[model samples]
Target: MPPAHAVTWRNGFKSAFWIANVLELFERFAFYGSKAVLAVYLANTIGLGAQTAGSLAGLYSGLIFSLPIIAGTFVDRYGFRRTLMACFAMFSLGYFLIGLGGMSAGQGLVQALGKTGYITSVLVLTAIGGSLIKPCIVGTVAKTSHPDVKALGYSIYYTLVNFGGAVGPILALQVREGLGIEYVLVMSSLVSLLLLLGTFLFFKEPEVEPIGGNPRTLGQVFRDMLLVFGNFRFISFLVIFSGFWIMFWQIFYSFPFYVTDVLQFPRFELMETIDAWTIILVGVPMTALVKKWRPITAMTLGFALASFSWLIVAGSPTVMAAIVGIALFAFGEATQAPRFYEYVAGLAPKDQVGTFMGFAFLPVAIGSFVGGPLGGWLVQHYLRDTMNPAMMWYIVAAVGFVSTALMLLYNKFFAPREAS
Candidate 1:
């Protein structure tokens, strides 16, 4: 009944794909929803310094992004449904405790744990939960999609991710403005619970091969990591690539405080929302335009554009400048993000694709760990002390350009080995 050599949508995708994506959407909704206001909550509610708050945020996000390196093996052993169940439970409990962190009712535990301790525990819980969720959902997509349409399946997965990201901030901002910050956390908890319920009711394991062939044992996993780390060129490329994430994370780590306390922007969360929206709007089209370019060229251009975007904000503190800056930064993000993945995929040997892809998150993790403190320092030193807030952007811009140059050098000097 179908056209020759073409699979119908109904036949190409299994129900697992839809279910996995739906779960992914809600998981991101909860994560980004909480992330939208986490920095402000840390700085204002708990009375921490800007620098300290940024560092904690960075640690939390860094762990969330990085832990997936080891989490996939665990999922491969334990199965997606069980891992997802635990993740949802952790997310629910973590969000609830985060909201509870603000309550004045628990005087005894508050005194015993201390504010920073309480917040850090909650962050750790959330990060661990998030780390598990990413791999499970992504792995599910891979397991379920027919090979012929796998690329389209991933495209759908990414689109849903960006959509959830865009919607999460807007929802969080509205909830925070309308009710209170505490309620926002409560909302995230509820969303996680909803996903947990969905998983229990609907999710079914998909048929797939053992991950990367028969799943590697714990010792084998460790050995695989050691082998991947032995590649000097790969490690260096990741470190250089990490510089971009350091610059990227400033939006979440420092921008809220910068805008509210210094620039007086009423709705700072809009910056994050705009970023997600731009990704959704232009990601496909831009990726299409540059599909033919070398990965290094795309990555270099992306870093350069993102680096320059900050200057627009630095030069003028006005709302219009902020819009222009964020928009340009979004374009830069679209340009580089897919190419970065493609480059990483190319770097992997046939057998180590999963291992290499797992390591791809290393840069994001490194960026968050280093970038958090760096952003905080920029704010505390330049904006808070000198009354020269725009100076911070200059430094950030410089970091981006430096990263861009490093990538170019890598391409020029290191890349030739592959061709040769």
Candidate 2:
């Protein structure tokens, strides 16, 4: 018989899962806190052009999603506790450097390195740190949850992540407005310090089964990656899905510019915070309503809803429209994201499960890499140079509409169905 059930959030989940979840919260806190304000900081404070700022932010975000193949191998070898500690330390160092650099430019510290040089270096450091954290925390969740409660565990984990995304920007707004932009980075560094301490004291590596083959060498990892690339159907589907993200990522790359530069709104960060809040409030109900829907159908609707969200902003130049758009976007995210992951995991052949899972991030990386400069260029040419600022949203909506159509076509032709 199982040991007497402990009074806890969930009966079967191990303490390690909760610990990993808490750590994920802090990790996201630092990350989103920095991200929510980064585009504006680059353009306004660093005095970089919008195109330059968006491109830099895109490169950083793309690498963070893409570099986990290498990082996961290191984590497998080095163990989770050490890897988590290193990641937190790197976050602290990166955020601290950005804060110090921004605060000390006139004093010649930041200027000594060149303004762009210092900022880019900070981003590179954070990307390396961010890349490592995703695999470690999600891997922990996968290891610690009992099979019966595994889905619930991930649901809770995602909810906490969205919660952190919500809280991070609110805290950033307060720090940036009440304190200063420099203090916002300092705040992120402080959160990283807490995570480092937590990792050292409480992060006991959970027990998990070993892989069937020999430990993954770098050569083996590369070979596995190439194998994934050789699967044409899978690669094509992922590329098609990447179009959604190409549009979605504009929240980070384009929304702030659209609000502040075009709409003349002072509270652009409010739009960022709204999506997270909507996720927190209605995610459960929305998920329940769509639980029986086909994954492809749900995803197509998600794209449609999210695509239409931009129309609210395009038609009206009010902050309220932007807020409503973000809320709608959040509901759309709730409809599609969970099902999307399930679909991807189901597609993997048994021997290639690990390989396929790692490649799952490829679409995200591709989207950011493509989206960043594209968003910047759109804002620069259509919004700043011309009278039709709203044309940017139309372009973003077009991407989403095309992606939704592609998903439907893939479903008809390629997707494996329950009836199949």
lDDT of 2 by residue, 155-246 (tens): 88888998898888878888899988778888999999999999999989988797797667788889987888888777888898898888
- Residue-wise lDDT of candidate 1 within 231-279, one digit each (tens)? 8877888899898999889988888877787778767778778788988
Name the runs in model 2 displaced over 4 angstroms: 1-11, 105-113, 209-212, 346-351, 416-420
Off by over 4 Å in 1: 1-5, 209-214, 348-354
TM-scores vs. true structure, each candidate? 0.95, 0.92
TM-score of predicted model 2? 0.92
Extract clashing residue pairs from model 2. none
Candidate 1: C-alpha RMSD to true structure equals 2.0
